[model samples]
Target: MGTMAALVFALLAVNILLGSYTVTIPDFFAMLGGKTIPGASFIVMENKLPQALLGMLAGASFGVAGAVFQTMLRNPLASPDIIGISYGASATAVAAVVLFGVRGAGVSVAAIIGALLVALVITALARRRGGTGLILIGIGAAAFMQAVVTFLMSRADVSNAQELMVWLTGSLNSANWERVGLLTIALVVLAPFVAVGSRELRGLSLGGDTAAGLGFNVPRARLLLTILGVLLAALPTAAAGPIAFVAFLSGPIAKRLNGGAASLPLSGLVGAAIVLAAHFVAVNAIPGTSLPVGVVTGALGAPFLLWLLIYTNRANQGG
Candidate 1:
């Protein structure tokens, strides 16, 4: 825990110091302490800081939500991105930006609605069949959503296409203090609900029959946790577009770090670290490119996904 905390803080500090243009550590500290150094304040405050903070929030939310979903579903592939939640959010957000010229809060609301609708469909489908069926259905739904998003992009004007392109890649460049505040409030409120429900979540992991036998209201608990997970995931997706794989990666990383401990708190911290580190690298290391942090994550996560699939197949064969 101490090591993880130190790493997280170190990454945060590094992210602050590095951006599109480099800044010396002393100058970065001075600007943070309110000393104006032409371009320093704008770079730190307006650009790098908000991007770092939003990256942390976005990563942490996805990590926690992904952990919840994976635990509840008992499947490693159960992530917001894989299960259609992120796609749903992104599709609606892109539509709002391209079709309606809406931005900010309006986009957030649309994303939330889209995520909820997708989740509802997933839940309804899952309930009708079974757990495995739900995973298959989710995959199909996600493919359909991606096709729709591609079609929408094709129909957009060049400028709109450019904007949607950046957005679709999941950049945090447009974040401001307003987005930071919204995400912070959402995290503060939603995190406690997850913590409070931890015991039930643990019980749910043991299977519905076992949880019910142990005096838990299995269905209600499942519903509550699902809602909590959706809100955690949806808020960040709205705030920062659909980041590629923080949710998908964090839980497994945490589990490995903790030697297979239940990966809630640790996953959240890992999520923050991954996002902050990626953002730091994207901003500082990449120079004038203005690369999306999500691109960095996607580059890393795609391989991890391949490995996971291989591991799952091998494990099934062994069983």
Candidate 2:
């Protein structure tokens, strides 16, 4: 935990000061102190600070949410991105922006509604079918939602489509204090549920029958945890569009680090690190071009996904 905290702080520093226009530490502090420091003030205050803060908060949210789902489901492939929540949020947000002409809070509202609705439907369908069924249904729903998003984008005029694409790609270009505040408030509100429910979550890993035998109300706990996970995923998606795979990658990485135990807080720290690192690479890895943070994460996550598949198959086959 200490290590993760230190790494997060270090990444936060790197994210803030190492952007397009570098700001010296003294200059950054000076700007913060109300002393105007040429471009440093605008760049640090208006752009990099908000971006770094949002990245930390949103990454933590995604991390915890992903850990919750993966732990509950006992499936590494059960991240919100794979299961359709992210797609659902993205589909509705795109619809609101392109079709209904919604902006800001309306778009955020639509994303939350979309994610919840999809989660509810999937839960309803999977009630009797178990975790594997839930994952399969979520995959199908994700594909359907992706189709909807693609179709919507296709119908928009080129300019509109380009603008919408930015959101879909999950850029932090428009980060502001308002977004940081909302995400922070959400994390604060959601933390207690995770704290209270973690015991039930650990029991859940022992299977439903065992969890019930252990005095956990398996269904009620699962429902609450599911709701918590969805909200965690949704707020970040609403704030920064769906930053791809932070949720998916964070849990397994954290689990490995913790010697195979699921730790929500550590998972969140890993999530923050992944996002900050991805953003850094996105803006700086290529010499000339800056891609959306999602683009970089997607690139990083795809190879990991493939490796997971190969590893899982080999383990199953006892190879």
Candidate 3:
């Protein structure tokens, strides 16, 4: 965990201090001390710092949401992005932006609503169907919400289409202090609820019957975790449009690093590292072109998804 946190911090420093337009370590410190370095200060203050900060907070949010959902459900496939929660939130935000001109809190509320509604429906349908069924249903819901989002984009005006396309692709290009503040506020508010439910996540991971046997309120715990995960996932999606597979990949990566033991905090650090590193690569990988961070994470996630599926299959067969 300490190593992961250190990695995250190192990446955070690298992201802020070194970008396409590099800021010398001395200039970075000088800027922090209120000394202006022309051509460097504005870029760091307005462009790099906020982008890196928001990406960190948003990545942490995704990490916690994914870890909780996966642990609670005892399924690696049950990530928010995979199971429709991210898509639902994205669909709402896209609609709010394109169809209603909603911004700020309005888009957030819509996203939360969309995620919760989709989560509830999926949970209700898959109540008795086990984790595999839950994921199957979630995939279907994600497809449906994605279709809705596409329809909205298609019907939107050209300007809205352009904006929607950019947001959906998940770039930190438009990061600002206001967005950083909003995302920070979200994490602060959601932390207590998530903390209250955190202890229960491990107990729940042991299975419904085992959890109940151990005095854990299985149904209540599930609902609480579900709601907390939805909020965690939605808040970030509202700010960064889901950012692809950070959530899906973080928990498993953290668990593997921890010798197959789960750690939510470590998972969060890994998520932040993934985002910080991905953003850095996206901006610097090709000169004069800044690809969306989602594209990079998607590239990283696709192969992992395949490997995970194959591993799961082989494990089941061997068992």
Could you say which candidate leads in lDDT?
3
TM-score of each: 0.94, 0.96, 0.97
Residue-wise lDDT of candidate 3 within 1-319, one digit each (tens)?
8888888889989999887788888888899899988888899988999989988988888998999999998999899999999999999888888878998779889999999999999999998998889999999999999999999999999988987787887778778898899889878888788778778998997899999999999988988999999999998888877799999999999999989987878888888999999999999999999888999999999999999899999999995
At residue 97, give the lDDT of candidate 3.
85
lDDT of 2 by residue, 1-319 (tens): 8999999999999988886678788988888889987767887898889998998888999999999999999999899998999889999988988898888778778988899999998989988898989999999999999999999999888887987788788877778898888788878988899897787789998888999999999989998998889988988998888999999999999999999999999999999999998888887877777778999889988999899889989999999
Among all candidates shown, the one with the greatest TM-score: 3
- Tens-digit lDDT track of model 1 for 1-319: 6787688878877787755567888887788788998877897889878888888888888888888888888787988888888898888887888789888788888888888888899999889676677778888888988998898898888998987787777789888999999899878988678886677778988888999999999888988888888887888988887889989998888878988766688888888899888877766565567688888989889999999899989998995
The regions of model 2 sitting more than 4 angstroms off are none
* Residue 83 in candidate 3, Cα distance off native in Å: 0.4
Q: Candidate 3 clashing pairs?
A: none
**TM-score, structure 1 vs. true:** 0.94
Model 1: residues with Cα > 4 Å off, grouped in runs: 24-26
| Residue 138 error, candidate 2, Å | 0.7
| Cα lDDT, model 3, residue 301 | 94
